[model samples]
Target chain A: MIEVKDISKRYGDGTVALGGVSFSIDKKITSIIGKNGAGKTTLLRILSTQLAPSSGTALINSHDLIKNADEIRKIIVSVPQEAKPIQYISASDFVRMYLSARGFGISEAKAAAEKALRKVGLWEFRDKLTAELSGGMKRKVFVATALASDADVIFLDEPTTGLDPFSRIEIWHAIKALRGQVILTTHYMEEAQALSDDVIMMDRGKILSKGSVNELLKGFDGLVRVEGRKRRKMAYKVGDVYVSYVDRRKAAKFINEGEIIRPIMLDDLFIKRGVNLES
Target chain B: MNLRYVAGYAWFAGVHSVKENYPYLIAHLALPLSLIFIVGVLSHGALLPFALAGGTVMAIASDGAGTAQELTYLRLEYMYQDFIVATKTGPIDYMLGEIFAGLPWVTPSIILYFALDAVYGMLTLYNLVMTLIVSVLLVVSVSSLAFLLSSRMKHARLIGPYSLIFSYAMTVLPPTFYPFNYLPRWLVTTLAVFPTTPAAVLEQGFFGLEPTAWYMLGILALEALVYFAMARSFTRWREK
Candidate 1:
């Protein structure tokens, strides 16, 4: 459980990464979804104890982020977006070493490393150097560390980015199997929809919405998205295309043959509300 | 500081660095060995003692300063600093881990120079122990400065040149390769600002080349404490 209170972060050059925002998280998995520069990573970093909030503070598992950062650190693990394994170290060694640094004994670290590498489907490649592994496998090495950790919470910053579809699904399952709180930031709406118990949508430096998948998509019961150039009774201009959200019965009238028509996704939240994400 | 985390990280990082970058290990030896060669060939062994003592001090100080690049790379490019910040690892654990990680690169050079010191008939039990003490102090002081330098570095590209400037200015600009007695008293006092100056002076005293100035040993220890304290307080382990 986490409670963020009026947290704001402003850099030295006057860049406000996070505005005054307050929210509480009590989900098994919560995904922060936003476009680039939406303050998603900034917020994750602040909560993970890697960055200090400029104005306010947060309580992670009842420990204050600033006042009790050291205690908080013992209960959390974060995999940064740009994190890469040391090239020369084997995957098994990297994970084991990470566990060791987290205070696990040698045998304990080895067992945890084996279990984690197996979960991420890299147990067979455990002895191979990270540089010898594929890009996706290297990413899995980091995920394995998170899986091996006994921490109460795990923060992943875009863990599945740049991975192939199969690799992404594998990582999704690994994350799903993790117990306790897992907070992640991702740009993929499908990822947020599929894995997160709750989704927190952000725009600029503020929270736009927060709810379960079904709750967030409650209003679009029988609606489908018809994307094309034709104007409809209810449509919003998204870049060069017009996305019209209509009842399934009325969607046929607006769509021409071979035009794009798909089921409604969480992205429609922006289009239905006339919010252009690309802008 | 969590000593357990520090020791674990030091072993992990140190072993891996040596294995993966074995070829680059020679980078640490090339400069000192080259200086020894130049001094040996030109002076026909007359000034071999200066090269032996100065080369050893230079190697230790430059290696200490060069650790900034490793810290910067770990922080900015690999994001290892952020990854570990969420662990039980503290700032002091990370700093000591990085300093010890660089030891494997410098260890062979230290042994070689000490062996050379023995061959040149300057090695004694007391000199050996005192030189080792001075070497450790030099590393702590210069590496603390390196930690400070890396913490303020924003870009990885800038760290390479910046650390080079640091190594040269702190190790070479000081009269590390020559006798302190060669310079005037005013210049000696002025150049003592660099840790390498006192470190070299202390080493020269241990080798019996210069009269043992016990005060220089105090200066090196003081530098280590001041720089270590400054680095402990100033380094940006957590972003604002």
Candidate 2:
């Protein structure tokens, strides 16, 4: 379980990365979605014990983030956005060292490394230098390292950022199989919708909303979407699909000779609500 | 650093990294030995001990105690420390890893140089061991200072030029290459402010030629601690 209260971060030059943001979770995959500069990474770093918040308190399994950081480190593992492998080391050796540094014995760390590589379907490439591997493959090594640690609290930042569809699906399943409290941040809305039991929507360093996908879908209920080249105050041209959110009666009134009527998808709601999607 | 056994693994990891990079290890050994041998041959073997001591100090100064290029790469280029710090690895644990990583590669070369000197009939075990001790201190003190200096640089490109200039200055301008008396007393006393100077002084003293003062030895130890503290202050663990 994790608990956060009124978390805020202020930089030396006074740029606020997170402001009074708070949430809680217990053994479930919770995703934080936001655009660039929305404080998503800052929140993850604080919760993962990577960075200390300037104000407010957070607890991971009753261990205070600041006071009991050493204890918290015992149960957590994080795959940060900037992690890379030493060019000379093979992937298996990299994981082996990582696990060893995490307190595993030589035999145990090697065994865990093999299991993790196999789980990620990178066993064949385990002996290859990490630098020689493709970027997507290197990301798999990181994922494997995280899995091998078997930590109780895991934070994965942009795990699927540069991965292909198949590799993304593989990581998705890998993250899903873990029993720990998994907190992730991603730009892909469908991924957040697919993997998270609950999603925290953030904007400008504060959480704009938080709920299950179904609960969030409820907020757009009874609203009608009118499509096909019709320009109105509520009409949003989302690619080829021109969507207009209005009252059912208003949508009916705007309907013309040939047009489509449908309910809202997460993407539509995300665009309507103005969530930062570029980052 | 946390004394937990968990941190001990960094020592293991450091050694493993050095062992795996055999190509680097080979170059590290070959280059230093070749330079010492060439210098020894050119000086008609009369300056063999000076070359040996100078070359040992050069290797130690070159590796910067393990923090120079390695820390630069870990922080600016590969950035694997991000993962380490984000995981169970603490700052001191990471420092230990950096320290141990380069020592194994450099220590063997130091041994070889000492062996070469012994083959030249300078083999009194006490003097040999004392020279080893002096060389290790020079490595630690100068490397700590280098580590502290490297932390100020913001880009990876600056690493090469900065480290080269530092290496050249520590080796060329000091008494590592000659006897302390080669320079006048005023200049020699001024140069003693450098960690490498006292280091060379101690090494030459152990060979029974130029007796080094206990005060010089004490000053070298104190310099090592002070430089280590400065390096710790310069290191950045938490993001701004």
Candidate 3:
């Protein structure tokens, strides 16, 4: 479990990155959704003991983030937004070596590395140099490295950013298979809705909303996405989709031969919070 | 810290790292060998033990700095340090892992030095023992200094050329291949504080043909300890 109380970060020139943010996350997957420069990375970095917060405190498994950082380090693992291979090493070998550095014996490290690679569907290509691998494959290697560690707490910053859909799913599956608490930040609303048990929506370095999927969407209960020729009359445009918070019968009436009507999702909730989805 | 646990697989890990960068290892070894080749061809075995000692330490310092440089890149450019900062890998484990990974890169130089020493009849038991000690100290101290310097930089690639200069100057300008009496008193005092200064002094003396400062050996041991602590303290990871 993790508890963050009023954590704030200000840079050297007095730019506030995070301002009095607080949240408690349990032993479950939580998604932090934010646009670029919303301070998600800063908050995650501070909680993971990679940075010092200008004010406030955080605790992971009852250890103070700053005071017991070394102890915290022993129980956590982090995957950055972009993970580059440290050398041109084989993916599996790199994973094994990192595990070895984590105090695993040869046979145990091999077993763990193999299991992790397989989890990410990379076992067959384990011998490939990371430099030779595809971008998604390299990202999966980072995911495999995180999965192999078996730490109690894991932080992944935009784990699937820039990856294709299939590779994204593969990494999501690998992340799902891990048996520990996970905190992930992403710009993909679908990913947050699909994988997170709870989601925190952030904007301007502050959390705008925190709730489960159903809880967050409760306010948009009457809303439905209507797509077709007639959707323009009673709808608000969201990218190519048309959405409106109205009676289901009214929304369905606008659906034509080529149209589709579906219930509102996290995207509608985000739009309701005054954000333009395209941005 | 369970250093035994770290050692259990660190050697194999080091081997894997070395195996992955075979080109780097080859290139790293080739340069020093080429220099030794040039020395042998020029002096026809004239600069025997001095060349051996100086070249051996030069290889260790230059190549040892590489370990720190690579680690620094991993931390800065790749953010790999963030991946490992958590986990049970202690500082001792990290140091040993890096040092072990770097050792094989310097072994070729060590072998070449010994071959040159044998050809010139400079491989006395005393010189051999003394050279190994001084070489190890120089490797550890200079590598730490490199790590320290690398840690201070925000950008990657700044440490390489600078460390090269530091290693080159530490070996060439010191008393390793030259006589200590050639320097003024102020210069000697300034160079004496360096870990390699005493190393060169002792190596020259071990050959029984040049002046040496036996006390400088103790100073180098002290400097190595201090530099090790500095490296540990300086090379810390921060989100910045």
Candidate 4:
């Protein structure tokens, strides 16, 4: 649904934000993961038609970003990394104003906003000033606003940055339930693993890797762990089927006794694949 | 003219402004009232020129401050980006909304001051109407200028001093306090080049000296047109 071709962004003093980055996103959750200053937010902003790239082109549903920004705006909704509620306005009133501004009738906007808020579990607090709400609730308001807009594509930049576990899960589920194409960025590896159909890892203003979880896991060698008497160690091997890695004596003890070990998780596999967990 | 949308945004802007800056509103009204009374008591007729100049200064300063606050709040708080991404409203809608939003707070004080002048037998209906027209032009021109500045400058701190300077210049550079005849011809011509000077000239029309209302109105219209065009031409700083 979106095509970004060779997009590059350079600031006035020569800070390269995105260097000829290119990617295509379809009607599924595409999670962009990167370290700090990796240009994930920049890529999402470009896709949302918020920032113009210095060179290259971005197309939303076949419309050129520069030539057809208004049309692209109609179909794109962006949840900025620092998304905040419009203080002094009630949540319901803010949503209604936004909808009305967008050309929807008051009743229609109200209905959609109510439904969207209810889905995010914030309908009861609709009339409260957004500034009075907690961080999680405010984020929910922004999420609800985007969902209510019913745009063809939604870009969420760090949607669950400061939320509690429950609120994060709720937001993740809400995002999971969205029907349109979604491009989201986050530092949370678990979120990318849980919600995204595909993942794009970025580093230093470039795409380091892009693929499904299974495809990404292919780069790591599978490992087997054998737990015996007092000490436990990991045995690494190259194969499709799971193998039992243990000391010769432990292997004999385990295989002879017909015991089974659990499969390794992606986190462990990632560490085993020479990815520095601390960094 | 999409009055419904215009009204919606105007209502949004006004209500938000009131809620956010209620203290400023109180101050906005109180400061002027205090100044008007003090000047009225202190200098008899001598204070009229200073009061007029000060009132004009207050009006422009208030308008600029209010506009800066509104635009800065919208941009920094991410409200502006939300509106930009929303399919329904354009930048023109925001511009008109801001223009209408700023009028009510500014108009009442100007009218009240002139009404006081009338009660004291200082102004006639002709003066009232001309002053009203000039006030409207001033508000429109300042509002447009504010919007243009907001679009160009991202931070509010930088805008405050610049806007204050402009307001000061608008009030003092023209013959707002004293007679233009006393000033140098070159100075008068230079002042005439400013939109605020023409607006002040239009206000002079209320005093029985029909000073170029058409020219002032034409300049205001041209300025509004240029500002609106510039506002439309500028691209917002989006996520990309």
Candidate 5:
């Protein structure tokens, strides 16, 4: 539902935020994974039409971001990182105000807001002042607002950043239930593995790799687990054979009676592709 | 600009303004009431001009507070952007919202001053209505100017220093504290274009010579147009 074409953003002082980065996101969840300063936020901002790119363009369902910003805005909702709540307003009132501004009637806005809050497990706290809510709850409130807007595409930047483990899992499930395209950014590999149908790994403002989980795992050889009386070690290796640096006596003791032990997940393709198992 | 959306912005601004300034509301109302009493007692009818000027200043001050709060809470805090992104309302609607929100504070001070004038038998009903209308227009113009400045400059750090400099210059430059005859003809004409000049005119109309009401209304319309244009330009410029 989103197409990004050669989009690049550079600061005035010559700091390149994104350099010819391009990706397409459809109806499923796509996770953009990278370390700090990886241009993840910049890409999301451009997609959301919040910031203009230095060059190239992003399109949402064929609506060009630069030329059709108003239409793009109507269909795309973004939850920015560290988004502060509108203080002094109750959560329910805040939601109602946002929806009402978007042209929804009071009853419709209320029902949508309530449904979104319930999805994120925040329905009970709707009447409390948003400033009085905990950090996790605040994030959930933001999430609820985006969901209640009922936009066609949702961009979440580190949506589970401050949530506890349980809340993170719950949020993941809620995200999975969303009916439209989703582009999420995170530093957690586990989050990418669990929530994303496809992963785009970025480093230094460039796309290092973009593929499914199996395709990414193909870059590494099979994992080898060695359990000993005193200690255990795991080593990744290639082919049907697994190698480890151990004492000859220990190796012999484990390989008695001429019986050969084989690694279950060993594959020789990564070795042929010059992927170093040691690393 | 949709009326419902404008009403939403006005409602939001009113609730937030009251909440943020609730603790100081008592002090705010008391200060103007106290000033009326002090001038009535000490000057004994000689301080009419001063009283009118003081009331005009109070109206502008209260309106300034409201505009400042809206700028800090709505614009800088990103609440305004949320509305912009979600709604069909444009910059004009946002500007009008600020004007409507500022009316509460400015209206009360004007009403109180007129009530005081009536109690003391210092002003007629016809003159009182004219003064109130002028006060409303002048307040809207000044508050719009303040809001325009706030939208252009996002940081709150500069607002205080700017407000201080402008307030001092306006208080001295206009024929607010003294008669317009005390100033040069060219300077007097130049200052007449400013909102503070209309405020002074309104003050004088209440106390003595009544200036042309059309002139004051023209100045107000000009101020509104200029501020609205500035705000629209600022919004587009900031997007870059």
Candidate 6:
């Protein structure tokens, strides 16, 4: 389990990335969802021991983040949001080197690298340089490193961002198969809904809400979202688009009235709470 | 120090990277070979031994100083350092890894210089051993200084020109290609701050091509430690 207490980060430029936010994760998989500049990445960076918080601290499996970062690093592997593979390195070499750096012996690192490549469906392209692979394939090479690690916790920041729909689904499946606790950040509401056992929603530098999918969706019980050009009395306007929440029984009526109807989703909550979704 | 990490990272950033991009061998050789040719012609082959020895020092020092571009690219562009930072690996491991990676770039040049030394009848067993030791320390000290410079940079694009300038300045500004006595005593002292000066002096002394000095070895070793310590502290392994 991971416990966080009053973590905050303020840059030298006086930009506050996090604001004394606190949360915990005891579930197998938790996704932090937020628009751009929402502190999702900052919180992950701090918890992964890559970035220090301006105030407060966290305990990962009882290891203090600030005082025991080296110990904490032993149990965690992180794929930062901006990670890219070396252009001249092949997929197999990249993953194998990473495993070796994490202290796996030669033969063990090779076998684990092979297993991870196969798991991520990149075995056939293992010998190809990242420059020779597609952008999606290059991204998968890093993901394969995280999969091959023996760490107790894995952190992946926007692991599927910019991927095609099929590639995204493939990564989602790989992430689902991971054995240890997984924490990821994404802006995709469906990804959170599909993968997360629990979710944390952040806006600006603060978390607006956090709970299980079922618990967070309780307020929208028996309701569907109807999006259209015509504005309703209680609809939310998102840049020229108007979205209204209606009872499932009344959803068909709105659909026939030239409005699009869909099931209520995680983003609907943000819209209902008047949260800006520009990012 | 974890020998395993050093060897692993060495193979990854050094041997593996070199194998994938063989053009680096040519890139490393192009400048030094050209300078060797120019010096041989200008001095009518009288200073060929000095030029060859200087070429080895030049090759190794420039490669080490050029590592700034690679480190900056790895840190800012690929974010590879972030992956290593989150591991149990320490700053020294990363430095050695990077050092080994850079050492390979100078291999062809080192071999070329030694072969030329053999042709000129200057390749004694003792000199060969001494030259190798000096080359290794030169790579370490200069690369450490490069790492120190790279850690302060926030962008990769700015590193290319700066590394090129720094590489040439570290080598050419000092008397790597010429006899140290040609300069006044005070100038040599100032140039000693650049690792290549002492490295070149040691190599020249080892080959008996110039007057020998025992204290130059002490200076080179001391500079290596100081630069390595500074780099380890300044590198941003754990970001704020």
The TM-score obtained by model 3 is: 0.87
- What is candidate 6's CAPRI-style docking category based on DockQ? medium
Q: Output the lDDT of residue A254, model 2.
A: 59
Instruction: Report the CAPRI category for model 1.
Output: medium
Q: A56, model 4: CA deviation in Å? A: 2.5
Q: Which stretches in model 6 have alpha-carbon errors above 4 Å? A: A252-258
Which candidate leads in lDDT? 6
lDDT of 2 by residue, B1-240 (tens): 543323443444456556667676666665456656676688876666776666677677766723577677777777666676666676656665666666777777777767766776665888777777776677668867766765676887787888777766676677775677778988867877678878877777776657765677887888888887877776777564
lDDT of 2 at A151: 86
CA displacement after TM-score superposition, residue B7 of candidate 5 (Å): 1.8
Q: Model 2: number of clashes?
A: 0
What does the lDDT read for residue A15 in candidate 3? 85
Candidate 4's error at B46, in angstroms? 3.3
- Output per-candidate TM-scores for chain A, rounded to 2 decimals: 0.96, 0.87, 0.88, 0.81, 0.79, 0.97
lDDT of 3 by residue, B1-240 (tens): 646435543454456556766787666666456655666677786654466656676577667667667777877888776666666665556665666667776777677777777887777888788888888787778777766776676777776777667766676667655556668968977987667677777777877767666887888898889998887777765654
Better of 1 and 4 by lDDT: 1
- Sorted on DockQ, best first, the list reads 6, 1, 2, 3, 4, 5
Candidate 4 per-residue lDDT over residues A1-279, each given as its tens digit:
788889899988899999998888774888888767889988777777667789998888998888888788778778788777777777876776666666667678879999988888888998788888888888888778778888778889999998999889988988876767888998888888888888887777888777887787664445344433333344333232233344333444664555555444334343454333345
The numbered model that scores best in DockQ is 6
lDDT of each: 0.85, 0.75, 0.76, 0.68, 0.66, 0.86
The positional error of residue A58 in candidate 6, measured at the CA in angstroms, is 1.2
* Tens-place lDDT digits, model 1, residues B124-189: 999888878888898888889999999999998899889888888776667776677888988888
Q: Point out where model 2 deviates above 4 Å.
A: A220-231, A237-267, B1-14, B18-20, B29-48
B1-240: candidate 4 lDDT, tens digit per residue: 445566766676565546655665565566556655666677676656445533653565466556756776677666555545545466667767777777656656676666766665667777666666666656666666666666666674676776666655665566554445566867766876555666655555556443454666677567656655666666353433
Question: Which is the winner by DockQ between candidate 5 and candidate 6?
Answer: 6
